[model samples]
Target chain A: MSHKIGFEGYKHENNVGFFGKENSKDGKDGKEGKDDICPVATQVHHLIELY
Target chain B: MILVLGQCSDQVIGAFMHHCVKHSVDFAFVDLNQLGKSIDMDELYWFFPGQSPVSHSDITGVYNRFLDWPKQNKYQMDRLLSLFDWLDHRYENVINRPKDTMSNLSKPYQLDIASQFFSWSIPKTNIIMNTQIKIKSPFICKSISSERSIVNQVYRQEEKAFYEPALLQAYIPGLNIRVHACDDVIVAVGIQSDAVDYRYSRFENDIFMYHLPGQVEKDILALNRTLGLRFSGVDLIYHNKKYYFLEANPSPGYAYFESQLSRPYISEALVSSLSRSIH
Candidate 1:
């Protein structure tokens, strides 16, 4: 089964806003804003394979 | 002139502004987050803070990218509503008016329209809200409305009754495909992710350009036209050598897909369309 463990417990739920600007909700710096990664600070189980 | 409406921090709006500058397209940006106390609205003119009042005749088109209403004073909210009302009732050449985009609020309604185009397949789905009905195992549950929610598989053993209404859909195992149509231009990208909802996937999604069949592309364009949208992002599942239509996003965040491509096809198409004078 390709289930992502603890997906409900993650920090970012809505996957809101892509760009970051001054006083933006997503991030303070544009660097962090553009960076798309898992919000949680731990490794996750990987499943599914597509080419 | 083209009027771009929404917050400056939104990537889609930012991309439109960037393209406008790069392409020398005459345009104006109304940052919704920066609205001050009030805006003076008359039949033909609107006066925002720190700028001369703009005549309605001066705008040929409007690119609306409003996500959610930011926390605003009562005066700002009233002014925003006034603007929204005018844009819906009196405007032409709006990429999409708010009212026209209402179909997206109901996923089943959108799917009903998608069902018209026979080229693509739609998964077996149902909206369960305070009703008794038989359902199969290995199904997924998601938000019935356009409200963002992560797609999660429903275990048969869990409580069958949902506290809140949700859409239960048969889980079709396959690769995910996102097709973005900007007016007549459509771009397809295949997403390979292990996560049920690719948006929240922890692993990096393998996004690659997918060349869709000629008829499929045409039908998608037709579907967009039927939905009264000049731009949309459609979700599909490629299963058993057939494409299954999931849902259509009227206000698509195309920046993520555009970032992966060598050229910004979606944004460029939008800019080109918005740049043209309505007259």
Candidate 2:
């Protein structure tokens, strides 16, 4: 077995309840989370926008 | 009035909206998700979901976090292009103009800019395509572009060769400090983690406020100014009494750091700066 670096292998599993996801206490995908800080709401291609 | 540009799903946009409402700041949310649906725009005015059409002249500042339009139609594509051009050329307080954010698209280019600042030292980096260039023993692989990729340590010789161009740099071991600068406010946070990429670390990492040296903080603000970025999140590694510049995230997903802090320092600074044109 190969060692996973960072979130390499665990990304899929950890996506459900990552560090920022904890804000979504109501479990509505951050709809009612504290201050509405939902991690999932961010775009996948966050920084870059391909022209 | 502040013009907020982003999709309805974006949390940073949500957080900014919350701040505006809480502070009694007048603003309009232009959800890009509704670009062609509920929203319509002529050359001079914008029609939001539920409000009177607003003239471009009325907007004093813009908080633009548009990653991409939700749909890709003829109208959407043209509007996206026009909007991007406007964001790039607009004189109003744009947190970060699109062209300024283009620096992050190329890590090598960004590193070159960082190298200009005295407080930052860049790791020996090589962007290789088909050719093999050797760096010191302990090196890590990173994405050449702004696209996210987990930083991986190269243990084997085979890993050094890249079929596609990638950034290979001498790994600097130390604390990860993220510096967020909005206009004049700079908030620095340190992350203590064992994983190569602390952002995706499986183990819990300690997040706390970090105070940068006065000169280093000044240099960071200068770098932001040089890049023409009103807002940015700079990544730095402090190792052996030196700080290594990683990269600056123009459209930083700051909600993560703000969640850990007692107050949303970055967001607050950002919102305050965006609303500054009013008072």
Candidate 3:
């Protein structure tokens, strides 16, 4: 009931899709959707490791 | 053939399909959400209007309207992007390959590059990972990767309300607005949201309007060029009469605004732009 359009809720409305955190199997202490806010960083690191 | 991703019946998807048909262009629809299993690449090589993926290799171009890719498997996302990359490289003659369309869809990357000019209003946002969600008493938190509507929450004066790691920002008291920034023209919708929540105002009765500032128009356009975003739906918040930059949607749902306003301004503009790009 208190749900709000995150974009409208916060100023970063476009970031709605990128905020989801899929934590690793480490559970609660594991990662959240770190890629949500900045997937570019992870993507870059992934790409470099690929090379 | 141009492939319009997503389901065919959806209004916006249908519009894109209809536009291709009206222009007598070759196109196919790839329902990634409907795609069943670990299929081979050949299954979706070519898209036939009024038809599903086929074994044919004559697929010349693609409109690249695949939004559901992110939701699909990494292979799914790569498969769709790969097709576009191939189409652009192999048959540039078949696909639009227009700069405007590309920029329009990459709103995030575009905004990243355009932030320099609009740094004042835009939030001091950082794309961080694993950094425990930091809050400043009454702060804002949202998942940047969310897809649903109104599922994002705003914490009010709570230190550890949800305890979930999310986007934390300094909550600003202002007007929330979405600006329809196509390649040529820019239009915006303003909402008077509760100084704190406002994001959830969709369910609550609130004041909203369509507005444009004389000064911001030029800068928005310039920022568009800087970001290489041909067409984008950007969120702009106005607090104390000064505008602030929120975010941008490269492939926004124009239908929502058009239906809510009972007008097809943005939708029609998008259709027209797509047609011109193909021609």
lDDT of 3 by residue, B118-184 (tens): 4336665544455444455555555544232232455564544334334455566667777777667
**Tens-digit lDDT track of model 2 for B1-279:** 788787655556665555555566777776676666666677889776446778888777888887664667888767776777777785467877877887777889889988998887999998888876555477888888877776745543443558798888887889999888888899999999878787656666788999999988899889988888878888899999999999888887776677688876776787677766643
Alpha-carbon TM-score of each model against the true structure: 0.79, 0.81, 0.59
Note the clash tally of each candidate. Answer: 0, 0, 19
Top lDDT hit = 2
Provide the overall lDDT of each model, using Cα atoms, as 2-decimal numbers. 0.70, 0.71, 0.47
Model 3 chain B weakest 10-residue run by lDDT? B92-101
lDDT of 1 by residue, B1-279 (tens): 677776544556665565565566766666676555443556787556555677878777788866667688898876777777766777767877777677887889899989988778889888888865545567888888777777755556455776678898888889998998988898999999888887766666788999998988999999888888888888899999999999888777776667667777887888777767766
Residue A19's C-alpha lDDT in candidate 3? 13
The whole-model C-alpha lDDT of candidate 1 against the native structure comes to 0.70
Tens-place lDDT per residue, model 1, A1-51, is 221111121113224323222313332322222211111111354884546
Per-prediction fnat: 0.01, 0.02, 0.00
Preferred candidate (DockQ higher): 1 or 2? 2
User: Which CAPRI tier for candidate 2?
Assistant: incorrect
